[model samples]
Target: MLEHRPVVIDRTGADIHDEARRIRAHGPVAPVELPGGVRAWSITGHAAARLALSDHRFSKDPRRHWTAYVDGRIGDDFPLIGWVLMDNLTTTHGADHTRLRRLTAKAFTPRRVAAMRPGIERLVAELLDELAAVPPGRPVDLKAAFAHPLPSRVICDLFGIPPEARARMLRGGETNVDTTLTPEESAANVEQWHREMYEFVESRRRTPGDDLTTDLIAAKEDGSQLSDSELVGTLHLLLATGTEPVMNLITNAVAALLTHPEQLALVRSGEVDLREAVEETLRVQAPVAHLPFRFTTEEVVLGGVTIPRGEPVLINFAGIGRDPALHGADADRFDVARKDKEHLSFGHGIYRCIGAPLAWLETEIALTALFDRFPRLTLAVDEGELEPQATFIMNGRLTLPVLTEPAVVGSPSDVTV
Candidate 1:
């Protein structure tokens, strides 16, 4: 019999919601294939995704019995297994994962996320001012103008990355995140990206700054901190988590609000809490549509079905957030004040996003300033003209072009050009 050619159920926000419904109605396990002969069972139901992801029965270690299910059908070098072999957080398991987690956990505490606020607010204003300078009614890619810079610059700043190195790191950061490439290509790029980022840690350690990287390096220098691999990988994980999702959330949230002017007006007029609203948007449509890939260490079962062993069992991030069974009647609606933390935007269980507070803080400040700034700002190009990031992992409007003319919504200044 021919190997199963997997079908793609959800490629966009609409499809992701639709697919989550489909999976819930059809039960938990769904099949899909990679470019090679590798087949994966995607867990769409939120509860099932949680269970499958957290269960110890699932063998996360790829080296377990690799000869049978995974042979040379692929290649010696592959991206799927590289994640487990390299870096810090993604590669470790058991005691190792636990140890490193303890050291880094302090940095992500709600207090720490809260502490970053003023700096984040200042950064948000700078980004908006830069965007405001762009002529209105003319096309400006909001991705580059506002959505992009707000988080990219914030993350780079938080990590103590210098301005001169920002462009190179930004380019490599996306390449490091792309999950679509062939195994060899992905592996090569991931390693090179880490090597490129090593300087960020080294530069900070040598001449210490008040940024997160410097702090982390200092921790590592103290007793029982992090290994070099853990230091770099954890830093890399932080960047990956911080940049893509926050930017995606900004663009996606702005797009959603712009489309629903009533919602925009409500947020602008202070009828909604930007924090609760940011959570609602993330739940409704997550930017990182797929959770980073995790492996099962042993044979596991979900929805009363067994995943034999060593299979790529994925937790659908976007699908889980929109599951009707979890969110009740208004699950489909985007209401900023909706308090639904049950949604899995930051994930659930041990591996839940540690930087969630940071992510939430960044989005709240950015989106709040966005609607407030352009009380009159509207889309520059037709919605269809915006690019779609086709990769499953990062779902977002590639370039959201919006118009900003006349006046700053709440400001005394008005511009002619």
Candidate 2:
């Protein structure tokens, strides 16, 4: 038996990196208490995280495997219930997970993701144009103005959601990912999200277009096994997955580059590839802080600790990235040129993020365009003044206030250059 008092993860202050380091000190698998005193285990070691994620004994279906959830201890009223109870590829396992993933994988193929580069470049250019319009020396909140909207717009276009409907989706999506919401608010937000997604599905069905949503509907009509719940759930997953993580990817990558001028200079000067920069950012500052809600099917020992069956397991991606056992002593340092850059930022095995290719494309394009337009961009406030989102699952700044020198128009039409 470990200490009676578990580390409460909810009170992580301004520096979450330090918090992750502190959790890692408690051993690879440490007991933790989330807000409202929800007891769980946190996998804070790199090797242990990989084992937990890939281990078949650890089921992703919380409804089936989580004893606390089955016994009502992890109720719907729980703040994090909205994430765990999701009925899409995230929560499904076995043949069901394989089937659902197959339906969605067609849309994210390398060829398809590559084909989106032109559109993504156009969107990035447009957003950068808007950013350039901001007055010099005036701090613009990049999260709201650029980082957030770039991916949102791309996702909306992909799903054939109208510009008008995006406002509703954005509003509900914001509320859903916000971990600071009260249980009541969280439930309400999730219901609202469901309603919006249902409407989106219905709208797509009524007016099918040359879009992924319409494609999914067609697949269902042509005897694909996607049910109503899966359809709505997948749409919600796409939006949530697309917007929040990708938004943070862009914002976090920019923040990383801004804070690490030496590394940023390499990317800016073409010495280091932007892809490398993005990879480094993903390793050091993964968009999602915690991979919440994996449940053990049977008692399992990891890193010298026994996790009882049916306990909720959280993979601390934040901690794993900095584990010295994997990355040596300089693991905490941000190095775009690091030789060993393996990380679980997008996860591992069959459940790795299906949208990772698109995300990488989006981030690379957005970063390349933004810097090309404003090569001298810098944070407007002290780095310490920037605040991360209050949520433990999502790791990003609430706002990235940045200033740049006046933009000069001398770019070729091709943003990929």
Candidate 3:
């Protein structure tokens, strides 16, 4: 047999899809190198990714199963250490996973998410009003002005994070997922994040509020439901997941629609709804592109390759989202009306994203209200000029500049869904 070489993934996230294409060419299960010269297997095909995500042999508890991590080869300076070492629902296995997920799900129930729709709609309207006030000729960075803040505000309110500390929380969340950080930067970020999270939890304990943080605090104090460390870790996970992913989803959908005018016309003519557009966007550009560090419990054969026991694996969501075998030859093309709009962007099986319902509601409302307010909105710069976010773990533009033109002449109430 020829010698196996690991494909080194780009840490800067310059062109993740291009990297994904190369990895897929290697096979469904491909050896890959992470930022710290760390070796892992990537699940590059749709079927393979789904199987790996739901397979019992794949353990999310890296502390127990990941040889490098357990043996001290992976350290604090590793760029992805923060993500791989978390104690939240994302990294737990078996009964621990079940318990954490159950507690987290209570805050994201369909009824709770649906109840927030009116508040979300109101927030969207307020944001649109602010965007409308910008001079017609000046280009606006939609990612900054609209996309990022909408989800930030929604999640902060949901968790009852004090307004004074929201900015630090947002910064810490961004730093946690950025793969391009230097060893010093990564270590500092992890330390800062833990400190801030602990402080926030303590504040919640001192003065309970009507929010998810308070509920989680209560569970932590219930003497068996949640440990103190788990409480902080869970909050950290919720803050990170609840903000950045939804921000990217809105920006990606808007970018997709702006680039594909025909698809935009379909939505404008009522031929396709905004929800369909959102789904298509998710299929093409998943928010979390490459989730980190699931290890194998035993030798497992997949796609004609065997991952040895204790070997690490990554779910390549970016590659799987556009897998040609499942999505057909034109998988890359953005089509709002495409049939069989199936995707594992939120994930699969027990690890499915608990905040998915809230994400969907936020995106749908934000998109509808945005298009309604600025019917003639178009990209201020060429699509090629857009810059990808600095992290391989998350997929989004660093900035999306657009011109909001021919503004609708109406009050907030005049804008109808």
Candidate 4:
């Protein structure tokens, strides 16, 4: 066993640029001793990282076997997303990922996501309108008003959560997000989040609705579709994964643009283009800081480091995107105008974020609509003052305060965002 030396995790915030810089100098992949009582091989080089992510020898399946971790068992600590998602998504790799991806593939197509845009636009408009009401000169938490709520609202609509349940589920959204706590505490929170999700799913299952939850219920009619544990993992995954990171997208993009006046001007002029800008933000500032931890199914060698079997590998995709080695000198520079697509912000191969499309849609809608509605929108609080969540899970600003001009309400058009 590695000395498992106590590495202090900077739970106060999740800026990994320094860590990435250090890893870049050291080597592509190295052992990262986490602050908490855990350790794993942290992979950083973009090309090498993707190669590792794509290789099947490294498994996402937690049951592959490993040393017992701090706080809780493997399944409880780093489990799958939630219930309906439990049996199929993420946990099972190989043919199982393929099968589940195939079964639900049609649901997330670009056309479908695009079709949901009007609703997403509506949600953005409503959120921004409320944000505009914050008294001027007072710092309003945009993370609460816009960043966090936008994605949850979109997810709620996707699942067809009713108004009463939607209000209840938003709390579920806040709690389910990933954190830097011990495995036991995180798992307990996860189990509680899962119970809420189960009741929500069960409500839909019993009532028979049109949302994705109902569809999932119908899709797996034979209760056999999801095991007890699988259900908990899947639901937790959606609630946490879906809400937290995108909140950063909104907060980070606003901060990035505001900090760079030239970039903000370009956005205002439409000369720089918002989609490219958003994509650039994604590449430049990754919202999620931790590498997706994969266990070594067998012995593997890289850069003179031989990872023994069953030792967990922590591939830090966050750093892979900004590798000066891969992206060149202009790499670190956040230029929305520069089209850089070789980013590792999303994982390589099959493990890449399945919700990327939805996330992109939400971000694109939020950003574009903001500029379109209030060209004068600017941070109400001092940009440097925002409190970013203290965790490696979904690293992002905890709140964003913005002052905006009143918006002209558009027709109440519902587009099923």
Candidate 5:
């Protein structure tokens, strides 16, 4: 086991999975420091994280509950402040949390997500066609060409952003999730994001359309009592959560498959189910590495370590996903056929991700289309050369360059030829 140390989360040019394993080696709860030298706790065990996330003693409302935040130690210009300081469902608790979540949930039901299948399938098909058009010998950054745009496009369509305005909205959303940006750049990006979303909400009010945004607005009109800031915050949350996870999910899944040919063969041969593959990818390489800055109401003993009151608690979902104590010594290995693949990739309890169903559908469709179109897809660069996203929050490749061999004519590429 590695000697427990104060782990810092500046993810630039670092291999996140390896770093996560090192943290896990330190024990379930480890000393960690954030970007601004802010001290915190990192929950690195699966069971421990599940408990901490659901524990009522911990609050997500950084603005009201976080002492560092209240004392100005953490400011809006802080690189990670945008995540913790939001006024959305993620940052609220008790009745307010229930009310906001209920209002948003009403519009984003399982039925509504299911209804998006045909459109999602169509969009995936179009993207696969574009990938096919790329020349065979040359490499294409699949992350840029496909993974990033697909989810944004889906969310924009569902949000009823007119076709014309989708581009600007997507650009803003991209900047908001990017951790590579300097603190100053992130602040500017946040401001730009707020301006765009605020305008979008007002526009939706003026001209409603057959979209989820309209549905949410109508729900508000029907006595939901959603304030303007809350409404915009909800919309921003939807856009950010909707894209970041799905984008990373797709990118990580592809990276996993291309690096593990035997597992990819099982997927291609239908021996291993696609759902199983996606779930395994989620378990092995969680889309979100660590959830930033959940504050404790009081001093809490976690994994035999005492965390002081109002200190930030970062749930290291990535570390937990690979914790051998929970998943056995082979937890780090990617095995699509592995059973008992329980994981906290989508989080646990009330604060769990609301867009999980949509994310699953999008990833499944994207993978299915890409593989069906070109079964011989392989990485253009060495797996080691694939750079991870600079931010510790998201564990995904910056660019996934791949070479897609043409599909076989006589039989499916996995079969003959």
Candidate 6:
């Protein structure tokens, strides 16, 4: 173990980028303390992060590989217990992981995601129409009214969640990523989320629908392909992962474009596509900032530091995205026209996010339609005054207040796509 004291991470989302810079100063593989006093190593360099993510020595299953959790140092009351303990595809290994991923991939096929484009465009149109109705001078929260609902509604519709049940599920997702919650509150939130997922699964099992949930249930009934626990856990994972990160992607992209008027002009003047803006936002303001709990299967040397077996590791997506070595000195700046816009915001290796295609399609459509409709949209407050989301795991604004300039709603012919 390293002799120096571990750097305690900020539970509050504020200063995460600053914190990442501080962690990088400690070295690529730096000792860090998670919320609730859980000790871990954070991978801060782009190459080191890629190695850790793809290396076979690093295992995602905490129940088997995490010494602290196995020996009871991390209890059920730990605020982040739910993240590591879940039995979804994210926490499986080898054959189990392959099997789970194979089963889950059916729902996210290229055809299925492509088919969602028309519906997604319609949803974007409806949202833009609603934003156009807001009084010109009054500030409207685009994050809540636009970003949050688009993905939430898409996921709910994809899973066949009833309109009445969606609000509760969305609230549960908010709780899942909130690292600032108390032990008691976190435990209770986990319990409630599990209960809600169980009910959802049971409801779908009883009344089959033309949705992914129904498809998954059918697989579960065929030759023991999935267990009850796995079924509920998969749904829970899908609902949470499907909504929150995509929500942040849209909001963060809009925030980036609004603050960086030069970048916005690039998109508006046809110098660059909206996709470039989305890619730049993903690089600078990664939606999932710091992912949790990849444990060492054996002693491994990373960045000249020795990590013992069973030690937990965190992949700092935020830090790696802005690494000067990879993205040059201006990595921190948001530039849509940058030649190299590569990022691990959707992750890497076999564990790379499966919903990435859907997320990209949703965000591109959302941004294009948004700019096309409200050509004069501007931030209601100074960029510095916008509040960050309360959790370190999710990089986004709590609210993006914007003046939607209803009078300037542009026609389709004016779109810069």
- RMSD (Cα, Å) for all candidates, in order, is 4.6, 4.6, 4.1, 6.1, 4.1, 4.2
lDDT of 4: 0.66
Which ranges in model 3 have alpha carbons more than 4 Å from their true place?
1-3, 220-223, 406-417
Kindly report which residue stretches of model 6 are placed more than 4 angstroms away from their true locations once superposed.
Answer: 1-3, 220-224, 406-417
TM-score list, all predictions: 0.85, 0.93, 0.95, 0.84, 0.92, 0.95
- lDDT, candidate 3, equals 0.87
Per-residue lDDT tens digits for candidate 3, residues 36-141, read 8988998878898888888888988888888878999888877788877578886888777778888878889899899999999999999999988876656789
Count of clashes, each model: 10, 0, 0, 19, 0, 0
Query: lDDT for model 2, on a 0 to 1 scale?
Result: 0.82
The predicted structure with the larger lDDT, 1 or 6, is: 6
lDDT of 5 by residue, 300-363 (tens): 8888678788988888878888889878989989999998789999988887888888999899
Computed on alpha carbons, the lDDT of every model, listed in order, comes to 0.69, 0.82, 0.87, 0.66, 0.82, 0.86
**Cα lDDT of model 6 overall?**
0.86
Where does candidate 5 have its weakest 10-residue lDDT segment? 408-417
Model 1 spans > 4 angstroms off: 1-5, 8-26, 59-85, 182-184, 220-223, 328-341, 406-417
Whose lDDT is greatest here? 3
Candidate 2, residues 44-82: lDDT per residue as tens digits? 788999888888888888879989788887777788767
Model 4 C-alpha lDDT per residue in residues 65-120, reported as the tens digit of each score = 35443223434444322211234465566765665554454447788788898888
Better of 4 and 5 by lDDT: 5
Candidate 5 accuracy as TM-score: 0.92
TM-score of 2: 0.93
Candidate 1 lDDT tens digits, 1-417: 232335554333334555555555555566665434556777767788777657665544444433333554445355444454555656566766667777787677787778889998998888888877775445577787777777788888878888998777776557655555667777777677777778777777789887788777767423678877778878777777678888898898888887778776776677876666666777887787765455666676676666666566667777777776687767778776666646777766777777777777788777777777777878766666666675566768767877776534555542221
Model 5 spans with C-alpha error above 4 angstroms: 1-5, 11-13, 220-222, 406-417
Per-residue lDDT of 80 in model 5: 67
